[model samples]
Target: MTASTANAQRFREFKMPDVGEGLTEAEILKWYVKPGDTVTDGQVVCEVETAKAAVELPIPYDGVVHELNFGEGVTVDVGTVIISVDTDPGAGPAAAPAAQQAPQQAAAAETEDAEPQGRQAVLVGYGAAPSSTKRRARKPQAAVPAQPEPASAALQAELNGRAAPAPAAAPAVTPAAPAAAPVAPVANGTGAGSAGRPLAKPPVRKLARDLGIDLAAIAPTGPDGIITREDVHAAAAPAAAPSPAVPAEATGPVSAPAAAPEPGLVDVAARERRVPVKGVRKATAQAMVHSAFTAPHVTEFITVDVTRTMKLVQELKQDPDMAGLRVNPLLLVAKAFLVAIKRHPEVNASWDEARQEIVYKDYVNLGIAAATPRGLIVPNIKDAGVKTLPRLAAELGELVATAREGKTSPAAMSGGTVTITNVGVFGVDTGTPILNPGESAILAFGAVKLQPWVHKGKVKARQVTTLALSFDHRLIDGELGSKLLADIAAVLERPKRLITWG
Candidate 1:
């Protein structure tokens, strides 16, 4: 049926829009509403992560949330109807004559490529996603409002076909059942009125039910001498023996459930599995592959006597101002790179092949290449050149934590002007690092260890580390790369110089 036939009022349905350039789909990370949550136009309704980034999606209509089209973690094509606002449901489009004309006018006003009316348009670069053509499956209207049930109670019903009562839960007031009075002892086994068993709370009884043991059989051992999970387990152990034995024969004999099927003896292979490609893993893989191939990489390395840096690291960690901050060797190295990039600005520029020109970014978007189980993702700190030392250190910590947890989105990982990979975390001295795509340079920070070095023209013990710089040869020339790397080394050799240089 057409939207006009279904409702007299002109209501709008908001779908997932492609928010990034060259984007096709995004994962619905979360939904902030159910069927009936009242929402205003522009209020955040959901969060979606595309191959390029994660973004908060806002409601386009001010109305009650009539439906949520997809669950969290489901991938939706651009323009899919993810949410709908119930604007005067059943009133039909005729109810709002002016509103109907408005959409037609809006659609007519746009170019042929522009999105349809009543749908949110895809934003460019951190904007809304493109409109999807796929229609969402509508669910039947509920007889009553559905409230979220306790997880434990739901799990119990799934396993045993009976919902277990939660601890201290208020007695449910259903349409069929009258309000239950305070639970009275229902004597068991022996007699109705012979002081048959010790009285316990309703939850204690549920615990006994889940264990598949009689409540009267369990001996209470908690404060006020109530039964606990331990008590229930203890009482049920002997009864649990039968459950374990049934599985043994399924394995020992010609097994159907416990072991794999014999070559020719195939049973019904019943079940469908859908795997979702969303979140950090999807974002990371795309970013790494893009960076690896698109950016023409040229790596350069330098081994420096960083004894002074190590000493400074220790001194800073102990200082009252830096005590709470993470004063690591990598933090200092990242700071030094930020400072040096100012002098050799060419190293911080990107080669735009399509434009046939170098795009020089005045502000530094410093990315930290983080290795996560999903893949390698580089989430950067925006405008790092302007932040203080402590602020930079804190931002790095947050960036690393979010990337590792697979929570970093495409937006945070994109638009990086330069990148840093701390190879030192892997206990390696140094190796050439790849430049992140769309950026001109990547710096590798290597492990620091006591090594022999010449100090004041004599051989001596010194804290040493290696630094590697990989640049897009199409943009950054050898001269520019060397100057940037050397300047970083100079900062490490003389940590005190940054104060004077800045």
Candidate 2:
């Protein structure tokens, strides 16, 4: 009670900010600071991954960290306090407030987030952000804990007093402790084990429950003995088990394609791994679905001879002026597309359903779709129409590098008017590209291959590639879309068009 209530003003709670375009949630990728660490104003406290991109969040003020409310890999609702700081640490010990106030704060937060007046729900695990203020009081949970373990569950995992049969590589309930069930609940707080309460975050606990893992039985391996996601996954993975332990619904899409492991040697289901979809992948899926269904998409394709463009690309690679830039077919194709947009500005417009109008953008935010370890993200270059070729190349390199590292900012990905997806990189010949949500058009550049062609009345091997343009038919008609695609092909066919048409 000391200073906890009396000096409550000393504790400053920092909530998760709306880090993306009205995104209601983000996952805690990592924490740079911890309780007792000093942090300054604008100091990065943690890195978070939203459905749009991964970004580092800086604390807005200075203080000594008092507590972190969540763990890594946990998706938290925006507006919920993620950390508490003792702004006036010298006044006295402020740690007691975290202990005394966590329950109250958690309750108040739940009520506030759940109130559906202005908030929008986002993502799956982020469902923690309730749609209603009062939670239903469910009582079966209490009664079930009082009952004995059923004989059917050979899943018992004992981390301390006894060891359960487990594959050598991963811990069973010894880490998840679910396999060690009958003995876990009374350990610390439901998550604690015989060794004291187990150290794990709420989302991790939820993962354990979904996988039928007992947290108390999990052996601690994370910093300060906290159980990590890998620990739970490992425990869930059986090396040579005859059958899968978790229910089919809980496991991720099993990757097993090989004929079912020879009967009895190894369980085919055991080879499966289920990774929860969240962050960028989940966002991209929802956006793609909405865009596909809402927009009346019309895709047009054109195969063009690019012998001159391919030759120019080689010359540019050897040019002393463009020595260090990323000189690739994509760079030239992007320039060609930009030139086309310059020739026809109306292609750079969006259909606003609410306003019942076609919004034309004065500036071009050119988006380049990049594939990263996390997922596909399209980060745009600002005011790209005005930049010189070299300057554009520099910005393009930075954007791609940033996206690949999974550090593209939400601001960089927003306000995009047009996009380009280079299917050529993956050796894809061509595809009916889909428009990025809110974008008017997307250009798909296919692989450039040497193919037989009639050149000046003679059969010869020439560089040829395909271009597919997808646009919103409601806003742009066939003629306008055809012109844009034609201009791109003309430029790529004759490199001089960048100067003439550009």
Candidate 3:
């Protein structure tokens, strides 16, 4: 069963790994290397987008990349071999195709029969997870020829009993067995049609709907004949070709159908752009849905005059202690929030639904909502209760910069007990921000605008802003929620409370 017998001497396979947090799969966002490219051990071969974040994957061993198993934009399973590297490139030319595949098959078989091994070699900062990445279960069923299927299709194959590898799909095939002749399987024999209902998961099905591509027409590269996002995209490319093909519509910008437009009908599909939901955006959507439904949320809004807080921000900017630091109203706002949390520590807690009890936390990992190119992510400033003003400002700057560049680690985004979302950055009045899952409260800081205010019993123009606090009603009631919001407003109104209340 050892691979060193023949082709194994030259070729070594690298499989996709669970990045962290029990992520089962990742999409091959981009490939940094190609076939015959020389690579060193620990060289980053490609970037992958998992449900949590975008992670760059490095090859665990040194070699020349013999082949790339999947194309870009394909979602691959955790244990699928992504790239095959020829470890002994110095030995002139490698073996034939059949010779190369034999050792790969043998090594794959060996892996299935092998015992649990050491921690998978992924990038640092991810915790060690239970690695049960065996592909043995699908050997008898899927038997794919090194093609990686979408993770969703793999899940369907696992739960819905084993399905046969579907026949190569026609670019214009439909589910009802229409007059369209099945085209030969394109690329990797993944899109061939079978004599049965086209097998595509709900999301892929929706993607087909959005693109106006028929599932039966796609060449499914997924295991057990599951159609994937790549297949849908592939089918769309040809459907837009100038050749006379029929029975399929398209919503993509490249779409050009054979038929003429109606006299007065607007082609809405032509103007629409459908981005498939996956990765960070997909994870964020699911988290928001879970939080919105599971947590009893109550949002309270307050308008506060923060003329003094704004003045203190300028004073702190010139102070020698605050020199070389990001001195802004947000720094004081965050500091005031921490001070308020210190006064009303109960706000920094969560509802343990399983235990039916309130869990009070002594330390606060404050979450800051950041919008990145990938999606909305809340990477937190850990242990903000203890960091000084300068230290807090430094960490906040690092966190924001990292998130904007899409380099924030998964560990940095977790373990938050409270959150602050500065909506004012977008120049809005205020908004009812949703609570981050598992966190009890979220404070929305609005834009500081100059408005007429009754100060010292007389109406005058003052720097005023609105604050909205959203809390878990199960733990923080109306009174506690009001007090927390009021305390934050009070500290902002009187900048000296940072010393007295803090």
Candidate 4:
């Protein structure tokens, strides 16, 4: 209505971006900025879990946060505005639009008659719809007044009143002065006596519901008394225990494991769970299936004595050149694979189905398959072929750390030329690893075991392991694949060849 209001600040909406592999949607795992926080360009505003990885999204502009469009754990579609930022905070509030003014007036009227529901009011266009369940009656002494309390005091009163049970000797306060006087709710339900809502992300709340665990029963372990996923899982563990044995007549023999029930006969309330395939696990599954079916895989295995490689790993740990770096047999194996690629560059090629040609890579973007909590992700060391051994080790260490922390960026996992999966960590003998999509080869390193071997015509115990290399038949022939794998095996067998061949 006034000039000051006419020149009010305009809000800008920031949409969620596709963080990896053209992902369509991502769940908001955590929000860093609240409604009133100031944010700068490139400042990370929130962490989102996509189908590929957990990515931290950086705001592209400087502004004051106006409102969040979605709550934590809600999966927001790509290109949907997730947050609104006031670009010109110095400007005064804009006059409400004609359509919004009527709604705002109606909301205010509704608020006047509404009782304190012991939960924060949900912002429009965010969070789950309010439940239809009726609120329990308030205590006779805890009546709310017609007037609303100030925002800050109301928030504090709600927090303190709901945090724990009130003492029996506490004095009753009139509802009109609720803010200055803390009024406790009547104990009836699991969440009764709490004026504030339980602090939990959407996923944790969903987990609690799925496990039929009461959030109020579990003590909070997160910051500011928020319940975490671990806390909910801890509470569910005891309840998840199996029920009394089913009668033999109802099932089958008790000694033998019960047969899987017929499709429609399965119990709906069975103890077993069926977790949905989504996020990283879903993407990984699709990729593996495509790679397995599309590519004509040719796998070759070789048993090699890696005693020298094991000794070199120990020696490098003590070496000043490799001090403070990750020195492991995997490092040497990766280096050996790189050297072998140089010797047989044809193996470092990708088959371009669209162009119907072999694309040979001059430099290697060495990929290491990391098994993370999310799923199996292959993040590569960029320009690994050119990096010195120490630099390579450092990059490997950083890559593994980032992957483990679920912070591996989309860029880090892209453009991989070849991959090495260390299945040996799980004590696997060897595996025919499928090629990473677009790459020609993936090498599987098996566990090293002491086996009897002929040394200069005498039987002796030696550290031996098996290596399996799977490559694209279209781009890499049997001869080229064998030569490349043999070279890698030879380098590991001697360990000194890394210095000579490298």
Evaluation by TM-score, superior candidate among 1 and 4: 4
Off by over 4 Å in 4: 1-9, 61-63, 88-92, 95-269
**Model 1 ranges off by over 4 Å:** 1-11, 36-44, 60-64, 87-287, 320-324, 372-374, 401-411, 452-461
* Native-to-model Cα distance after best TM-score fit, residue 487 in candidate 2, in Å: 1.6
Cα RMSDs of all predictions? 19.4, 12.0, 12.8, 13.3
Instruction: Summarize candidate 2's per-residue lDDT along 1-502 as a digit string, tens digits.
Output: 6655656667788999998879999999999998999999999999999999999999977889988988888788898888988888787644555444433343343346333332221211232222334443332222123222332122333233222332233322223222211211112322333333455655677778878987766665664345778778777776623333443323323455567556669665657777788899988889899999999999999999999998998999898888899888888898999999999999889988998999998899999999888888999999999989988988999998888888899999999989999999888889998889999999999999999989899999999999999999987899999999999999998989899877
lDDT, candidates in the order shown = 0.68, 0.77, 0.76, 0.77
User: Which of the numbered candidates is closest to the native, going by highest TM-score?
Assistant: 3
Model 4, span 145-195: residue lDDT tens: 433234423333333443222223445565653343322232222222234
**Which scores higher on lDDT, 1 or 4?**
4
- Model 4 RMSD in angstroms: 13.3
Estimate, for each residue in 1-502, the C-alpha lDDT of model 3 and write its tens digit.
4434566656777889988678888888999998989999889999998877788888987878888877787787788778888888788875644424432442343334333332221111222233345333422332224333444343333333443233344344234422332122211233322223455554466568877987755557775355777778777874454433222222112344469777998988778777788889999999999999999999999999999999998998898987788888888989999999998998889888888999999999999999989999998988999998889999998888888888787788889999999999999999999999999999999999999999999999999999999999998999988998899999999989988887
Clash counts per candidate, in order, are 21, 21, 12, 1
- Cand. 3 Cα-lDDT: 0.76
Please give, for residues 1-502, the per-residue lDDT of candidate 1 as tens digits: 7645655344567877878766888777778889878888889988787775457888878777766756675567787777767866545334333223433443343343333322321111212223335442243322332343455234333333344453454545455533332122222221111133433433345446654776554445653334555666676664343222222212223235567777988565434444344555676667667878877788999999888888888888888877577778888898899889877776678776787988877999999988776456788999999999889988888898887776676678778888899999889989977677688888999998888888999999888899999888888888888998999999999988778764
Q: What is the lDDT of residue 270 in candidate 1?
A: 38
- Give each model a TM-score: 0.57, 0.71, 0.72, 0.67
